[model samples]
Target: MSRYDPSAFPPFAVTVDLVVLTVREHALCALVVRRGEPPFQGYWALPGGFVRPDEGLAEAAARELAEETGLRAHTAHGQAAAGAHLEQLATYGHPQRDPRLRVVSVAHLALAPDLPTPRPGGDARSARWAPVGELLGRGGEDGVPLAFDHAAILADGVERARSKIEYSSLATAFCPAEFTVGELRRVYESVWGVVLDPRNFHRKVTGTPGFLVPSGGTTTRQGGRPAQLFRAGGATVLNPPMLRPEP
Candidate 1:
């Protein structure tokens, strides 16, 4: 083979844009930051930044996650990670996607419980969680258009979350350490945008082997008789997958 020429290929920068999602106030929300710099100044966008020369893609994503949301990335075992459930969602490389240069973004999806309020970082003017429907203009009212191709990225991430929870116990990432079946069902409802039958949901979840390990405790947090609390079990994949309801 002939010698490889570094000058033969055009230079392009790589960035990591995060679609950090969480269920807040009965709605599925995503973390967004207002741009403080040009190219999309003062406009809302997904939290992200260019990848550094020394870090890997996952590391870059985790660093950006912490810097923007103040949340740590955890190793997902049978359950969602300690702080969040993170995974590579997709890649966007449309030539005109970035105005500054030829750039490709490795998008990551992070699912976590209602995180504490975010602190802006890098070139972010402000950061907060916004309902996915409002951000994507699917909430009946006119919504805020995101900067760059972030709107598409956010949609993809949302769909990923919606689908994964059907066959995997990924939704637990949106719940506290110990949660009631009703709380877990609500997580499914919020992410899927549908109300599930409380009785049926409890039956199915409780019957699923290894899906949950009872914590031997109960609480009246939801108001009413005390509800049993449980933690995520050792089963990552649901045996009989919970199917989405027909529209």
Candidate 2:
């Protein structure tokens, strides 16, 4: 047990926020909820809430993810990996980030495989998977800035996903359990916002040892010729990392 002297330091509340991304309609989109209460009522914000007395950072993150987007934490089994991919993103505790309280938010990054719909929960008035480009867009229909420091948090999450996938099997986090190379390419393209040479990208990923395992089946998700289906292999880190081009 630990003790805190009230006079030693000022108290601060803790919260958890999420940057949930997915490839939908071949675009990278983020999960956002409309704030229903004051401070930023009626504005869209990253879905989150204060940490409960008994929960850890990840627990609070998982709980908030479930409450906001109807996604749940991983169970004893690994099936939830097919549902959501979550990890710590960063923390934000700017003195002015929150107007109502002294809040320090531990942010998390989550990737969902091609999810197109979302249900709002907690105090959210509505929820949707809005295209990140538009949410960060200047003058598009979905191009409204998010409330609070969420826009900054989102930009960071996007960059993290973009960078991580280049050296990790994390791109699979944006694809289903069994996906074609073309499907996986689309995930990379959407996240990186770049069009890649199909043949070259195919060669690179396939050549990398243990990067993909053949599922002994094929599908024509891209139409025309049927493509071989594959699953994420045993390797977590890429042997020859897929590097993104300089911006």
Candidate 3:
């Protein structure tokens, strides 16, 4: 036999945790599930499951999302059949994360412009979208009080989204396919938690090539003139990006 290191012990199983975020009622929300079994049983936690022996991490994440929330993988107009956007968030491999066994979890992040009614499945007692700020900032001294080290995973996902918004056109992922500049600004404000100057936001968005395309349409406003609507364009990165507020 070839001389090779065979004594290295492999860690326990790996899993995929998801932090599905959405702009609901003008606030940032994340999908959470109440655990049905022991080890933080009956408490709210991130939706996740063990990775299968035959699937990639991303595939497992998509599978868990569909199994738990009934959200399909892909649909037209960025609309999932269950109304959500699914993407990889990050991987958590802390050795002591799981109490029962050594488990590494790859977290995924999702975005949806419209909130869908969540239906719990698999090992979840209930599934719903909780506001990101509440989930991330309102927990007791333990910080999310989540099952496992999920609070850290959730924080990572949220920060990933916050940073992605500055460079990628991913903010549109939080808006409808066709939207007004005002609506787009609201997405930014909601995610960043800061108000943007409408005139400057409009100028920057309109001036950026392949950022927004005019739909040649207008909608009547409650008390003002009609506002023009535009659709998301091809650009994925902002050249001179809209910066996040300094904390």
Question: Which candidate number would show the highest lDDT if scored against the true structure?
Answer: 1
Each model's C-alpha lDDT? 0.87, 0.85, 0.80
lDDT of 2 by residue, 20-82 (tens): 899988999988898889977888899999999998888888788788878676533223446
Best model per TM-score: 1
Clashes of each: 0, 0, 1
Per-residue C-alpha lDDT of model 3 across residues 1-247, encoded as one tens digit per residue? 8777656776589898888888888888888888899888877888889999998877787788888877656534434444456676667777888888888887878777866878999989888888888877865122547788877888888888899889878888887767889888988888888888899999999999999999998877424788898888999899988788764
* True-structure Cα RMSD, model 2: 2.6
**Between the candidate structures 1 and 3, which one is better when assessed by lDDT?**
1
Candidate 3 to truth, TM:
0.89
In model 2, which residue pairs have backbone atoms overlapping below 3 Å? none
Evaluate model 1: give its lDDT.
0.87
> What's the lDDT for candidate 2?
0.85
Give the deviation of candidate 3 from the true structure as CA RMSD. Answer: 3.1
Candidates sorted on lDDT, descending: 1, 2, 3
- Across 164-186, the per-residue lDDT of candidate 1 in tens digits comes to 99999898889989999999999
Better model by TM-score: candidate 2 vs candidate 3? 2
